[model samples]
Target: MPGASPAALPPAERAAYGRHARTRASRSCHGWFEPAAGRPDPVDVLERQSAARLPELVPIRYGRMLESSFRFYRGAAAIMATDLGSLPHTGLTVQLCGDAHLLNFRLLASPERRLVFDINDFDETHPGPFEWDVKRLAASIVIAGRANGFTPKEQNTAVRACVKAYRRRMRDLAGMRALDVWYALDDADHIRAILSTGTHREEAVRRAGQAAARARTRTHLQAFDKLTRVTAEGRRITPDPPLITPLRDLLTDADAGLRQERQLQSLVEAYARSLSSERRHLLRRYRLVDMARKVVGVGSVGTRCWILLLLGRDEGDPLLLQAKEAQPSVLAPYTDGEQYDNQGRRVVAGQRLMQTAGDIFLGWTRVVGLDGHGRDFYVRQLWDWKGIARPDSMGPDLMALFGRLCGASLARAHARSGDPVAIAAYLGGSDHFDRALAEFAQSYADQNERDFAALTAAGQSGRITAQPM
Candidate 1:
């Protein structure tokens, strides 16, 4: 089968390859996790990342991470990458959500204006062993469960549930036609259906409906109403100090601000080139009115991010876009090296590959000379029916249910880019892999706690500055 592609091979042959993978790394072996004696300091890993980020915002990132162990885990992808790299893997590859914590799975509007549940973040996405993502997600469930004061048994149960869902969903995808697998999407109704099968069916279904309704209200127009103000000159983004500062306020100098504004406009034009012609034409209808530096996400706090306000047709019609900096994935050093010339393009490509549907305005651009240094950025609509889960608000049963949803969603995403047949066969028809991951999740959650304490000590000892938001 030298000339035959993996997808072209018979199902039996694909399953054989999966079974063969167990020789390189056994399924049960994944349960064991002990940090190497010479493991790199987790804080040091974070410091290395901070060197490339804005110095002023680095403290805020630290502050966010110091809030809890789970918060620290969200920002510790690079640390985990090093740990995971130290272990043997099965060599089954997929587009990993390098930071696939439970929170990253959320509700967002698809291109067809339907509220869909899917993986919403891709800053650290790259091709890697499929189990890496499963481990990341499983560990997150344990960590979140701990934060919510769940017993160890409850935490293990949640972790097992998540892994089981991933395994079963991969098996289902394996048996489906390639085109059907590609076309499958987990919409709001589908999520309600899944929730209805759980212990608290009525309550879960009601919450799902509420979440969908809330997401629908989070549109670009809603963002415009909340984040902008009508000034004497025109509509401008309201400044909210460190969290949101318009370019003019940052530059202070009138001449420098004007130059920076012009540069950003040109970058927007460049980003439009990456989109399809139809979307570009639709974009051309709006004119850039304002742009502001914005801080976003627990892990991405210090990176350069901007909110661009564009107005179309009239003052009432507005478009909000976010141009977020794209740094090299935290998984870069551990996995195969860089694959794309522009980091922004790398992010966009991965998102399009894994997501069932994407933002119509999604694109990328590289900026030059604005600050005498070049940087890459990916652009997308600022708001489109977005809703994130609050882990603290969830009980054990609900948390487990959410974990199942995340797991199934993750399996769908990996199936788009990896071999589901091979993965399903590797997982088999038992709970062996699920139990192994549950074990691994507990060990990693313990490691995460140690790392979080190290960060807290760093902050208290004046080794690192932390400014509460």
Candidate 2:
């Protein structure tokens, strides 16, 4: 079994292996939970991450995390990685969404223009235990459920529904042929059906339709109209300080600014090489017109993120691409680092593998920073019919439905990389794992509260600074 591959193992043998694993690592071990002694400090990890990020924007990141306990859990992937690394694992691996919080699952238009539900962030994605992703998803539900003021019973019910959905979906995928599993997709209609039984069914369906309609309209032209103005030279990005600032305004020297422009041009050229020839040809239709530093997401606040506005055929045509910095996955130190030298490529590869359909413009590049150091970044269309559900707006039942969707989607993603047959066998035809996950989710929810409390105290004591948006 030394070189045994999950993919190569036969279904019977894999099932046997999974049962054998269960004997050693009891189903009960899956429920075992506690903060490991000498766990890494959450704030210390944040500070270290900030070192590579723009210093001026670090406060915004902290402020976003400080907004609520659930928000803190979303931004504290590094902290949980340390804790998860110390947990008992089955040695089963998948392309993990290292930060599989409830909010990270969203609806977006696929290449075919159909809206599909999938994991939306890969900044910390890497190969890891499938259970780790499941655990993180469960914990996030618990924390978010608490944030929504769900009763303890309601919270446990949501966590159970999530784990049950995951278990059932994995079992379903385990039985499917390889090609069928690969072809499986959770589209908007499928998600609508899942939420159709809840008390807010009509409202949910109405919202889903509205979201789908809204997503279709959120194209490049919409973004261009909203963010750029018809300038004397051409369409230019309107300056919005702190949130969206053009690079020209930051680099004062004329010679230095010219060099920076050349560097950006070279970066895009390199990124184009990562795409297929057809996509590259399609990209050549546009000319890069303007770029601006744009702050995005709670955990991604300080990281170098830019939005490049490209003008296509005429004044009416436009394309927006986001170039976001890629660093080592938070799981890197806990497990082996990425195989690819380019972290950006690692992110793109993980996304392509886990996602049913991805942005055609997805690519990676290397950029020389203002500090003269190079960083890896992944580029993709910024507003490709994307829509996210606001957790605060949902009731307990809707949140539970969202939890189920997240669980099912995570199972599909893991099925692509791990042995779903074995995972299904490991899960068995029972709710034991579901109950165990509920217990673990609650325990971790308590830990999250403690961690959030510590972080809040740190901010209050001036150990960390926060600037709320």
Candidate 3:
């Protein structure tokens, strides 16, 4: 209750209110899934979103989305939000990972040097219905199950495991002290135990330690070795077109390159203001060496992302930071406007509120682009022992186990900003919510396939462009 806003009603009354909500919007209604009347075309939604992004990179977003139905689902957060908005929800709000796809959860090194599993992406994070996150997470399992060749029964089992884990975890969190729930985190050992077994499990343990060690050791020196080389004039980042291309290569004019360098310098200075005083001082120790435009993630391909390589006391000491563009959350329209004007701050604040351990260098800034338009961006370490459970390679059993792990993690995240007691009461003791969610997952998966096919047809008909096969 330390940071929680005081409620007019007591805890028990709030919980009873949730139970009452079930009568108006029965837990059974969660199972209801059908395309709403006059639903907008998913492709059209995507095309409208593309208009605001970098024109050249839009095709890459479409290209990556074209790979599979699951990938399409990943990139189509806006489309899903439109559908989720039409559904009957409990009206209870929480900080949602608006794009809570399976791949977005990953392992990262905590500030304490321990490896932990958490929701790693927050580009679309915002306060919204708690069920929205759960629904999206459940649908991800169904889509991934299909992509991994799981049978219908196996996929249903995965969905059940996920929803059940969420229910059980919410119930557990509800009984615990509020401070305890805030302090809870999923460590590497616990996550490995839940998701891996035999050689895979043993490998996970080894990898966890290795990942921690690498995070500590993989500073600017390691990055310089991998991404830069000794040049006649100090060290310069090697150019890898499309993926990592230096600004110098993109800007032929010397003055133009200098202007970009100045812009980035100003951006970093503004970003430093968002960090703690200690972190700001720590950041000042490094000097920017090079920067490049980098494309990251299937859904984020079209966004403006840049990597800044910095040098510390000497060439041996280095740091790598990524500046990723942040736009309004897909949930924005449905919910009230955010308190923060800058979307980058919105993303950073939501991330800090939800995750147990957040990036030490996390910060936000706004900058004018080459086109003279302003954009908001958040900055953090590009990588810190980040890894994901590859759903495509996992068997049904392992995938189910991983789904449960993701489910529990998500529950803890929601509890941070939501009423766990209310959520648990709404779920009840039986598997009603689980079965309902499973059915909804199946129905949504079918819709995803249809939407994906629509996009493919648009591409084939030359209405929309896609990457070459």
Best candidate according to TM-score: 1
In terms of lDDT, the best-performing candidate is 1
User: What is the C-alpha lDDT profile of model 2 across 153-241, one tens digit per residue?
Assistant: 89889888899999999999999999999999999667877878878788878877887788788887788888889889888988888
Show where candidate 1 strays beyond 4 Å.
Answer: 1-4
lDDT of each: 0.91, 0.87, 0.85
- Candidate 1's residue-wise lDDT over 1-469, tens digit each? 3345678889999999988899999999999999988999988999999999999999999999998899889989989999998898988888888889988999999888888999989999998999999999999999999999999999999899889989999999999999999999999767977797778778777888888888899999999999999999899999998999999889978888888988899889999999999999999999998999999998998999999999999989999999999999988887873499899999999899899879999999998745689999999998899888888888888888888899999999999988899999989998999999999999999999999999999999999999888
lDDT of 1 at 14: 90
Better of 1 and 2 by TM-score: 1
**Candidates sorted on lDDT, descending:** 1, 2, 3
Off by over 4 Å in 3: 1-9, 192-224
Q: TM-scores across all candidates?
A: 0.98, 0.97, 0.93
Q: How close to the true structure is residue 2 of candidate 3, measured as C-alpha lDDT?
A: 25
Decide which is better by lDDT, 1 or 2.
1
- RMSD per model, one decimal: 1.3, 1.5, 2.8
